[model samples]
Target: MKVVVDTNKCQDHGQCVFAAPDVFRLDEAGRLAYVSGPDESLRADVEDAADVCPLQAITLED
Candidate 1:
């Protein structure tokens, strides 16, 4: 699966990090960072992360 986060809408919120630590995180500058393509096994977690994002900046694609 592919993960996309819209930086313009993201506000450095770490919800995605908690929901999917293996795929998303905060950089040293406290900005949002993530793996664009993660293993298929992680789809559920990635979906949860997208659901929890307060700004709804996360997108998933096959």
Candidate 2:
């Protein structure tokens, strides 16, 4: 699976980080950062992250 985040819409809320720490995180500057392509086994967690993102900035693609 592939992860995509719209930087324009993101506000560094870090909800995705709480939902999927292995795939999303806050950089030293408190900005959003993530793995663009994560293992398939992490699909569920990624989905949850997308769901929890307050800004709806997370997208997933095959």
lDDT string, candidate 1, 1-62, tens digits: 88989988999889999999999999999988889999999999999999999999999999
Q: lDDT of all predictions, in order shown?
A: 0.95, 0.94
Candidate 2 clashes between residue pairs 3 or more apart in a chain or in different chains: none
Per-residue lDDT of candidate 2, residues 1-62 (tens digit): 99999999999999999999999999999998899999999999999999999999999999
Please report, as a residue range, the 10-residue window in candidate 2 with the lowest summed lDDT: 15-24
Q: What is residue 7's positional error in candidate 1, in angstroms?
A: 0.9
